[model samples]
Target: MGSNSHPAALYQLRIVTRILALVILLLVLVGFLLPTEYRVERSVSINAPLDVVSENMLSGQNLSQWMHVQGGRVESFDGVLQNDDSIRLLYDESDEIGELTLLEHTGNIIRFDVRPKLSTGLVHNRITLEDHASVTEVKWTIEGDLSVGLLSPYLAFFANDIAGQNFEVSLLNLKQQIESQN
Candidate 1:
């Protein structure tokens, strides 16, 4: 090279830096512009007998005692368990009321589909039991997805963390409730 002035090189470097910064900004914008889908799954285990714990979950009336909600009331029932089954009810989370439906019911497993407040899709909850010697492991798992959009990824991440904690807390509360009954 001939003779590059100090100021000339400095100006060139500044221009290059500005272009690089613009490219990075564009990349970030594009990253957010891309569509994304999110799914969250959370579970917790409680120590109890499989039959007893599973029976408790199947009893729809007992849901209010352990679940995260403002309150829950049984609407109507037409099942063998009488008051144990609820036809309709609301699980209140702040101002959000989750409409729940009893999807499937078996001996040791109960599945409930929840339509969250104003969100799209339904969250499926499966409660099952596995015996461990004197104690049965009661496992409650929630699996669902959020609507896709720019905020979907962020919402998904937050929902995963919050929903996981919610299940953990519910399990802890359930453990206390069941144990206290003894």
Candidate 2:
């Protein structure tokens, strides 16, 4: 008889390939429906006053001393608490030049807009403080947009996993520095 079994195997292979292609297409479509925005918040309670916490978190020199920006060390931070000033950032690598501008400083809240030179979007950060006798709550939040480009929404979905660890480390460092100084 003719090799009908060979034709059957080829048919099965084509079906599998078509299934895989459809699955990939569906995944891409689902990604398009997702959001490209992300917000990450991390907090630590320090045995310090609100003023003390604000000083440490809002001061440029103090911030550069403790905060690690994208695993990069701060070269020089300018315009400490200078409202509406566009403070420039420089890392050891010249290409790491970025812009940080102070947006607001209200009663117990401070906001900033940060844009990395190599990035396509700006990150808006807010630090909120709540004071309780003998212990102060410091909440650090970062939100950003990556545009609606393919894979941007997926990238945002993992933003907390990626940026949260960095924020924890930075906050821990700040806590230690503040507590140690007191």
Candidate 3:
């Protein structure tokens, strides 16, 4: 009777602590097994010529007209929207923006490599225009790797829907801008 209560209480506390440790270990194992990268692609057909679409797409000055970018400013730019041109952009005065480099430029395809200032990952943005009779088929793709390790898979899971909506909206705006002018 002198020590019966103390032994029982100690045993109960050990059981609770072991259960919590096991739960945490399972969660960590799941996180490590999840994927960490994603690619988002969205496309739309525009009732405009390829040249018209290409010009508007390549011009940095027209970014605000069709894209919902917040506090975006072109810090520096070189060349004339052609291959090898590099543009430094700052958004919301945050160090999260990236540098856009034109990796490929052609009559029907344009590829850009984006290097973020605060992240170790790179983003590949590609725009392709195909002539379909009178309508131009525009395909926009953005692929990137998430560098946040265990938490990246959770982010990638929703990246497509969120980013896809933005892409669709921007494409609709671009289509309207080009068609209205023609």
Q: For this target, which candidate reaches the highest TM-score against the unseen true structure?
A: 2
Query: After TM-score superposition, what is the CA distance of residue 141 in candidate 2 from its true location, in Å?
Result: 1.7
Better of 1 and 2 by lDDT: 2
Residue lDDT tens for model 2, 16-92: 99999999999899998988889999999999998888777767677777776774654455546767967666766
* Candidate closer to the true structure by TM-score (higher is better), 1 or 2: 2
Each model's lDDT comes to: 0.63, 0.82, 0.78
Per-residue lDDT for 1-182 in model 1, tens only?
A: 44668779999999999999999888668747644444454454556666767677545456655776435433333323332332444543344445666766677667777665545577777877677764767667777666665566566657667677767777787888777765
RMSD of 2: 2.6
Candidate 2 weakest lDDT stretch, 10 residues: 71-80
Q: Tally clashing residue pairs in candidate 3.
A: 0
**Candidate 1 overall Cα lDDT vs. reference?**
0.63
Q: Return the lDDT, model 1, position 78.
A: 32
| Candidate 3: tens digits of C-alpha lDDT, residues 72-168 | 6445333257788777757776767767788998999989877755365677889889998778999989998786866787787788997798789
RMSD of each: 6.8, 2.6, 3.8
Provide TM-scores for the models: 0.65, 0.85, 0.77
